[model samples]
Structure formats: C-alpha cells, structure tokens
Target: MSKHQKIVIIGGGTAGIMTAASLSKQKLKIDILLIEPSENHYYQPAWTLVGAGTYDFEKTVRPMENVIPDGVNWLKDSVVGFEPENNCIVTKFSGKVDYDFLVVAPGLVYDFSLVPGLGEAIDKGVVCSNYTDPIHTWKVIQEFKGGTALFTQPTTPIKCGGAPQKIMYLAENHFRNKRISDKSKIVFATPGGVIFGVKPIAETLMKVNERKDINLRFGHQLVKIDAKNQIAWYALAPNMTEVNPKELEISTNEGLVGIHYDMLHTAPPSVAPKFIQDSPLANQEKWLDVNLHTLQHTRYQNIFGLGDAAGIPTAKTGAAIRKQVPVVVNNISEMITSNTIGDKVYNGYSSCPLVTDYGKMVLAEFDYQNNFTPDPKLKQMLIFDSSKEHWRLWMLKKYGLPYLYWNKMLKGIDV
Candidate 1:
C-alpha cells in the first residue's frame, strides 16, 4: 500500500518541476510524488549564451533538491518502464509504483552515434558542440585562428532549431573584432531549406547571413565527421534544392561533399528516452503521444505529457513549455476537483531567441500554423518589431528569462 502513489510525476526537469510547483502553489490537498534521477536542474536556454562566452555555465544549474517545491515529494529514481493501463510506473532502484494519475515529462536525450565519428569526436579536439560542452565550445572558438568554420545540426528534431546558427553568428562577430574576418569563412549547413520557418524571421536572418558574408547551405545533413583530417562530410538531404545544389563552389567527393573546416560546432542527434520509446505511451516518432492542446495522453485519461518529450508540432523550447504547463496544470486541477477537465487549450505557442551576433537577437514567436505572433506586452515596454534584431531582446535572453525561471516560473508563479 505504501507503493501506491496519488500523483506521480516522472522526471524533475523543467516540465516536471514547474508542474509540481504550480500544483503545490494551487494548494491542492493531495500527495504529489516527483520521480527523477538527476541531482541538478539545468536552465538549458542559457547554454547558447554560455557557448558564446556571454554567460557563465555555473549559473545555469541548481541543485535538484533546492529547486523542488516545498510540498511536493521527490523520489530519486529513474523510471525503467510504464504500465499506463494499470496506472503504474516501473523504477530502476525501486519496484512497481502504482499511482492514481501520472505525468510523464522525461525530457529528450542525445544519441551522437547517429553520425559515424560524432560520438567520439565531440568535445575532444576541434570538434565541439554547445549541447555537450559549452565551455569547450567557447575554448575552441577562442583558439581558432581563421579558416572555414562549419556549423551544422542533425536532421533529427532538436530543442532549439536556431541554436546551430546562433553560435556561428557570435563566432563570426568575434572573428571580425579580432581582425580575422578577412580570413574566416562561416558556413551554416542545415537539413532544412529555409533559415527559419516563419517568413519574417527567415527573411531577416537571410539578410543577416548576407551581411555577415556567411554561406547558407540548404538541405545538407551532417552524415560523417572525419575529425582527424578536419573534414566534415554531408549528404544531399531529402529536402535538397533540385535545380543545382552543389553550384560547384565547394568540394564534392563521390556522392558526398567534404567541407574542410578549421573548427566544427554541431549538435548530436536527439531523441526521446529509450524507456519511453519502448513504452506504450510512444507515438510513431517514439515521443510521448499527447493531445496538442490539453497535454493529456491520447489514450490514457489519467496521464499527461509535455516539454521536449511530448510529440507536439512546435519548437521544443522552454517558451513552449511555458504555455504547455498552464494547460496541463489547469486540466489536471480541474480533473482532481470536479472530475472534468476545463477548456484550457494550448495554441502551440513557442518562442526562439535567435542570437544573430554577440549583442543582438531576434525573438521569433509563432503558433502551430506558422504565423508570426508578437507579444503585446512588448509594445508596453516600447519594444516592437521582433522580426528585426534588437539588443533589448538580447537583454531578455541574457537576464530577464533567467530571472523569471528562477524567481517565478520554478515557484509556479507564472510571471
């Protein structure tokens, strides 16, 4: 009977922590147990800034016990499997844990083996990734003299779609300030054709790319990394432009193009946790299958999911989680109180702060329909036209968001 839990939340990451805190703040007279294995809660959005050397990595993490809300109970154990039918979850250190309701928010993890040498090459030498080690990325960025600097991301879905190019833009600016602009060539090779999905944001970034003299290689996926030779190989991705992709400007060998680089910054392939992918809760893409708006499991009424692990058609950033948490919390609160969920629906809102240079950023906010939606409060703050780059947005990225995450969001205040 002690193993029977009232409300069990899997994962203590942003999603899990925020949900538990919000619920605890609601003063709901119920037991809530959060299951997580990690000892630290990371503020991952700041990693981009850390890679740019504009922010410190130490400030981005807090002890797990420090951030957990006062009332919510935390169980330091990893979930090995799930039995949604029986409303139960299996743990690694513990046995079967049954719960009246469950919240599955275990976030995404990396799988660098997708590329041949990426797993072994990352953070070791010239190959550096902010996702893995922002400190090493900064070190590599500073140590580079000048040549071809390659930036790329995997074809798989990542947390921030704009991160691969953010560091590139920062590094480009750094090179110019260091008097190496004439000798440096920055290249952004991505599987997607457009610089960004939103029309206004894409247009602005394309212009930024042009102004910085950076090459935008569309529909090129990182297939292999010959780190010893400092050669990055890419394949013509499925979305490759048909007319004339190569343009005969870069080197092409056999069917692949090998771009020799002085420094390479790339994100490893990311996917849902293995236990989740193998569980019944997963969709075809192996992510947690949940209603886009309600954040409730498509099949299991007593379960819900959000954050990077949810199979939502939106950017998997903290901003998206900001919108998702309210829906999940409200729906669950209604279910617990009235035995019926409310009409609180999430519009798939997500925001990406695209850092173009060291001190400049563009806040790209949109819905699931790919429409550019700006926050009205920005107008009150005398901030408008987020499609264009601004330092104020950079301020928000560097300081404002982090403040909210620690003071308000983690405590379930929601601003």
Candidate 2:
C-alpha cells in the first residue's frame, strides 16, 4: 500500500524517536511516520556496565511502542530500498511509503563476517562481545581462572569507541577484587596509536593503563580468531611512510601474530546498513551524506540524517545523538515552516563517558577537532572536573544519563 506522510522517519532508534517527539512538541500539524523493525529499543551506553556486571541488561531496553511519540505513526517494518527521486521508500513488510521529507537514522550494522572465525565463534565459549551479548561477556569474566585476557578493538568505527576498553578496565577491577589480578594478564589490542582521541583524556588513560598494568598494543588489528585453539590472530598495520627504510623493511615482512587467550572480549567491525549503503543518498563512504553542522542531507534538502549512520567525523556515541537530535529537529521544523534551513549549527559535539573503574569515570566530551568540550551544565550538575575520573560521573553514567534519555530526551524535553 502507498501511503503518504508529511515527514517519514526511517529507523525508530534514538535519533528517529527524538526527532518525532521534538516535532510533535512543536505542534507542527504535520503527519510523521516512524519505520522500525525491532520490537525493543536499547539504551546502548549502559551495555559496558552490563557486561562488567554493574548494570542490568533488562533495564537497558524497553518496548518500542512505549518510547514512540504520541502523534507519530509507527510503521513496524524495515526499509529494503530508498526511492529518493519519488520521495518514497520500499519496505519489506509494508509495500511503499511516500513522504514529503525523510529522516534517516537507521544506525550502523555490526559485521562479524569482517573478521574470519568471528561470525561462528561470537558469544560462544570464551569469545564474547558487549555489543552482541553482554550477559555472555559477564559470564566469561566470571568464569575466568586467571590467564591471558585479551580485549580487542576493530579498525572500523564503532558506536562507542571507548567501550572496548571500558569493560577491560572493569574486568581488571573484577580480577583484582577476586585476587586474580596477579595471575591474569590483561592486554588491550587496538589499531589506533593512542588509548583515546583527546590529548588530556588520552594522557590520563595512559596513566590509567600504567596504574592497572594493562598492556596496550597499538597499531594492531584483529584479522582472525581460532576459538577451538583459543588463539586470536592479529595483523600489524603497515607503516604509512618509510621514515627508516631498514625498520620499515623489517616491519613489512611480518606476518599475522597469534596470542593465546583464556578470555576474549571484542567489539566487532561495523558499517552502514546495507539499505543505506545501497541508496543514492549514501556518501562515498557508504554512510548517509548529511551536512555535518546542519544534519541536513547534502544532496536532498528534504532529507536529514543523524545518529551513527550520518557520515560525521566525530565519534559515534549516544551522547552525540543527544546533541544531534535537537539540531535536526529544529532545522526540519524551520524548513517545514519557513521553507529555509535553520541557521543554528552543530559544532560536532559528542561525548563518551569513559568508565575507568568500578566507581570512577572520565566524562570525555569533545568536538570535531578532538578538543575537550565539556557541558557546563553537566559539569555544574555533577560538581566535578569532567576530565578526571570521578564517582559523580560514574553515577551519571550508571543512573542519571539513562533517566535523562528516557524521560527528557525521548520526550523532547531537551535537557
């Protein structure tokens, strides 16, 4: 069936719901349709705590119907293809949906197949990831008998870049409490050269790594896993420039390195959803092409994109979406009412609550340039230096943020 909406939102995720709710608050007298396939909505930021045995997994989720805005029409279907020229979408469950404007926030898709042996071994035995199964991760951590515990980060952009290491710190804390720290060797293998993007936070995290004795292996990417043999293989990233010809020559000859692990936690590689990748609106990188500042589609003014799917340079996190929602909503409303884009610009503001230990977190807020950008209100509310690890930030991560997300952000209260 072909039905038309004044505004059609693809994906009932954090971005879509907030946009609809924000629009609804304006009382724009426009019909909004939200398309999503999942029956549940997840508060993904808390997954790190869930994997570390701090937060409940059930609390991170809610019925999709419960969070959807009051006035928006919910289409319980997945979009298979986009027809931007006709201003309609082809869905798997619903035949066709036509719209005056479209909002794309379908988020990224996890590709386990990117790593050989990962697709078959994930959430099985000692191989577990917080992204897929936090319960299994907790179980893996619980059953650990003090050996090499390896946590890996993929080369691809993940939802929360700090998550791969968050659980590692928690596991280290767990092992210390269990008196197995001496017996366990915790190693963080990542492709990035530093622990974090921001300098101050990275410097602090470097010290945290030193304090925890967590071995950091930079310029390494997970290429394969041998679940049966309990071996994880990594490919060393090639040097871009041949500064020292002899050193570069030696490094280039290296092969896949293997490490034995008793416990392994990984954040799988992620990419744009196939539907978004196949669309005409996708950028060269296969992500939804939107103006980074305006959150408006570059090619089609009527289309807006946000959340993880938007091809923005900043780190993809829920906190980023929290800031992005208002920008997209206001611009869309202005366009509908004034027939011109809003002047308000998004400064590429995004945040990551880096959980350092059981009761401590480093609230890392930054902009596109990787400069530390703390929320003054958040700083005042928590009453602590956001750059330093504090229990207050942990409390915010464990309790306050989730509450704010459900009650205020999703409700379009704009906190």
Q: Which one is best on lDDT? A: 1
Q: lDDT per prediction?
A: 0.88, 0.87
Tens digits of per-residue lDDT, candidate 2, 173-226, equal 999999998888888878887789998899889888888988777878888888
Off by over 4 Å in 2: 1-5, 239-254
> Against the true structure, candidate 1 has what lDDT?
0.88
Candidate no. 2 TM-score: 0.94
Clashing pairs for predicted structure model 2, backbone only: none
TM-score of each: 0.96, 0.94
lDDT of 1 by residue, 61-92 (tens): 99999999997889999999998888899999
Candidate 2, run of 10 with poorest lDDT: 242-251
